[model samples]
Target: MLQTDSMWRCVCALVLTFPAYSTAVSGVLNSPTNVQLTSTNMDLVLKWDPPAGAPRDLVYTTELILRKPLMDSKPGCVNTSALQCDLTHLVVSIYGRYTGRVKAQLGAQSSAWASSDDFLLDKQTSIGPPNVSLYSNGAKLEVSITDPVFVHSSLREIYYYATYNITYWKKDRMKELKHISGLQQNRVVLHSLDPSTEYCVQVQIIASTAQKPSTPSIVHCARTPSEKEPPWVAVVVALFILAGVLTLVVFVVRHWRSLSHFLCPKYAIPEHFKESLLAPPKSSLYLVMQTSQPVEEFSDQISVVMCSRTEEDGSKKPAEEKR
Candidate 1:
């Protein structure tokens, strides 16, 4: 009877070691994995390994609990079958230390919580490289840089870092190269550079804390135009153009008067002379005769008469001989 009891106990132990439904439920709540916070929008991302030990009849579900200064309040939670969650909408203040955790749930049972090593939530990353823009101001190459927005209000100032390659070359020969570095405001003013040389330039940025310098910007090149003028050259050019326009306007006004006289004859004539000129009578004729001859010899010759009569009256008048 004792031997039979021992055999039954052995059978029970074997049954507990490997349940029929246990194969479907298997996971472990590993340590908190990826932990990072974005500076701009205060977005938080947390990840972890899959959890272990779920009830044989239930599927394992993962939950994320994020809290500032450890698990103080009911941690903002999310339930998913995946291993990670983004906690972007958490309204935690950016003042104190922050900690996050993950837990696995299966039916009424939950695995151990895995928490992240505490880190300050209010930390701000260093600024990025300033956006460099290139331009020119008469015979000089100019650079303009715009600063990045600061996440931490403590950042008060930004400094520019720059380098350049300037060269003068001929057929199969090159000479006069230079590299320069300095700290200044957002604008770099280069003076007395070689006028006819080709130059390539790059710019970088550094913050007040003196972090690792940002990656240098792409190289830009400009050959200084020949040194022929000063800043006042633009004003001189404008004045010259204005003088030329004024002279042309005066010439145009004088020429326009002559053109008007030639095109319109009525108003173009002198008013005093026009009043003395008589209007001609319509359909009339005038005649004049001057001669030195014997009066009797020309007595029978027909003569033209100056008449101011209508055509009907002239046609009815008969011819009469002079005595």
Candidate 2:
């Protein structure tokens, strides 16, 4: 009975080891599915779905293949556990066509690469929103655009060939849409705008004919400056008026007595009194008288009187005489 138990145990061990050995020799990893290529402003990205029933520890490898206008470059990613790869570091021409592939890999076994649909770099790639800056220059608005920089060296060349699409309008009037396209320069001047008016501006990137335009940038606003009055001009006018008022006040204070006397004098003569003093006398008269005292004591006392009158004809006559 002990010998029978030992044989049974050996058979159980073989059965267990056989299955593990066969799995290592015969098992092949499955290919990744749904491989796709997409682009952002900064880089091109390759993505794939893991194979169904793949092991929890399965890793992936990715490679980029140039299809048109062929070149000798093959850029690849290796031993990555993630589902996505960034191929922006590869320096391929913007006009060239590209395709990508990915595969599932175990320790010693790897599946066939699942290829992605072909795409052109310029046609499929996208660029980030441009940096917008605005300034008010009198009645005009100055707009400036700046392109975004990528982490990959190969993607920087897109900025050189990129053109811009700009749109601007008054803030209150949304129906009036003004668009400017194919602008190579970073700065543009908007003219014939009302002073102190609010305006909104937006910008997008158009890399080439093959590429779609980038998403529009955030709206930015700026106001044109209002006209200003000169400070010196107002000050000068006020000073002139003040000087005139002060001069008038000084003249009145100094000559107040003279002005009053000229209006009403202190001494004056009446006309009727002056006429009486100038008229001549109409007549004149004269008179004389005499008296005796010592002779009248021995005899009788005697008294005598005389008078004369002058007329307007200058004749004089004695009216009465006594002896």
Candidate 3:
């Protein structure tokens, strides 16, 4: 067992380091390793790892094998230095089986052809989600889908005909989702939607006669426009606003004096009115007026009487005695 293992390791090393020289015993160089043929939406690609000891500058040639007709990797993939080749045009039908063979060549020497495993397009091909765009029209939403771009071939060349499965729902009512299937048109309109509502939609492509459908597109959301307003409603609102502003301007020009009186009054506050808001009540004041009492009257106590005569001693005698 150890001897077998050592021999295998030596063979691997030789293949990795060997140039494109055919061996004397086999008359052929080592073949490529890990050859694989893959399909992306029916776009065929052939890839492989170089021989273990293969040198650089060794060109490769690839061939496509079908049931009856054999095809060469086109677009000058022959003698190509690239490790991969595009054989998309060689795929005639999705239901057909395909295989790829590649050989390394350097001048007069060549390697044994390395063949890939059988490839079934319908079973092995990978499909991608469609591109989605949304347009809003009041109470309706319009969806537009674009097919995913393939590496070599177009979507129509493979599928011939395709349909879409659209799923949508109101953002608020997520549990109540709706689906529309088998829609043939690339552009579709969803009507009867609630006005001014946000709705989300996702779409998936179903290739005709294909067993698998493309992945669902990313979620897209758009809000519908509000319900249509009467054409004259805006005009009426504008006229009313204009009239109110004009009326205000006219009133300001006419009664500006009255407004100024309140805005900048000329009258001073009376002493009573100047009292503090925090002052005590009238009964708590130093002097309180009684509404029921009559006002008191006062007179001069001294009377001035004309002197009838003067006393000889120059003293003003009593006017009554003189009289």
Candidate 4:
């Protein structure tokens, strides 16, 4: 009876220690409670820690499982002693939120999986930079671009802005050419410029997360011409006045010479007739008078004179005093 009782006591002690052994086993597989994922060329990685408070004799195994949400009832698992596991079988599809889980394993028992954080993947190829153009129209500079026909998003919102830099006569410079969002078209016009000045303009585009600008567009140049003067200009008017004055001076000098000739004439008469013409006429039918005084006394004077002579034929001589 004593031997039997001692055996029963030993069995009871062993049964009591079983719970402690299970608790220790739980601790070994509970180390890693948090899960993280990273991606590379063609693989996704699952990262976690070792079991919690485990003794050196306790061995742990990490298991990572991935699946398409709501589609795969059973998640594919990676069984390994390493803290990180590569996801080579996971496929990337249309962009969306993905679900995954990481679990801890010890011997034949496994702990509930620690849920993983959500991840987003963009697998579409970029459409590259849109085409750009810089040109000049009369006094204005024009900037133009082609809408991105091929891009990552079909309904993607697009925005655009541009800046122009000019270097003239050896000086550094910059100008904000444009800042436009959701334009209906790609063309813009700039006006108001100093005439005869040289200018340069730069153009850029935005689509999806705004593409990198084009290699600074080639330089474009234009020079405005000076306006023309009116017809029959002021200069011609000044010349006409100068010519009219010169013609008037020539006419006056020519008329002065002619008037002087008419006022005073000089002539010499024949010597014989000169005396007869100078002699006073004989008075008969008229009277003759000569005054060596001022003409003020002649206001009431009326002068009359006659010339008479006898010819060889006894007739009143025909008076002939020729000069």
- Say which candidate scores most in lDDT: 3
CA lDDT of each candidate?
Answer: 0.53, 0.79, 0.82, 0.51
Task: Summarize candidate 3's per-residue lDDT along 1-323 as a digit string, tens digits.
Answer: 99999999999988975753436444566788899997766688999999877778888999888742444343326899999999887666666678888998877778888989987776568778899999996579999999998764577777788889999999989999999999988999999888899999999988875668887899999999998898899999999999999999999999999999989989877777777655766773434454446779987566555565565767665553221
Candidate 2, residue 270: lDDT: 79
Query: What value does the lDDT take at residue 289 in candidate 4?
Result: 42
Q: How many angstroms is residue 185 displaced in model 1 relative to the true structure, after the best TM-score fit?
A: 2.2
Predicted candidate 2 versus true structure: per-residue lDDT over 1-323, tens digit per residue: 99999999999999989966775788677799999888765467899999987788999888888888884547578989999998877746666677888988898898898989997776676666788999888778999998765544333364457678889999999799799998989999988787788999999877655357777888999998885567999999999999999999898789889977888779766777778767654434322122323454455545555555667766666455433
Task: Report how far off residue 75 is in candidate 4 (Å).
Answer: 4.0
Candidate 3, residue 146: how far the Cα is off, in Å: 4.3
Tens digits of per-residue lDDT for model 4, 124-160: 2233334556565666656575544432233133223
Q: Please tell me which model should have the higher lDDT, number 1 or number 2.
A: 2
What is the C-alpha lDDT profile of model 1 across 1-323, one tens digit per residue? 99999999999988987653364355333333343333332245555655344333432233333355455533455456656665545535545455556766654445566676554433433345556666667777787766545443333422223232222222122344344454556677566767765666666654433434444566566676776877899999999999999999998798997877788656466776676565443433332223344456434656564435457656444455544
- In the predicted model 2, the residue pairs found to clash are 123-210
Which residue pairs collide, candidate 1?
27-51, 27-52, 28-51, 28-52, 29-51, 29-52
**Each model's Cα RMSD:** 20.6, 33.1, 25.8, 35.1
| Candidate 3 RMSD computed on C-alpha atoms after optimal superposition onto the true structure | 25.8
TM-score per model over all chains: 0.44, 0.55, 0.50, 0.30
Which of the numbered candidates is closest to the native, going by highest TM-score? 2
The reply for model 2, stretches above 4 Å from the true place, is 1-26, 53-55, 71-75, 150-162, 172-176, 227-323
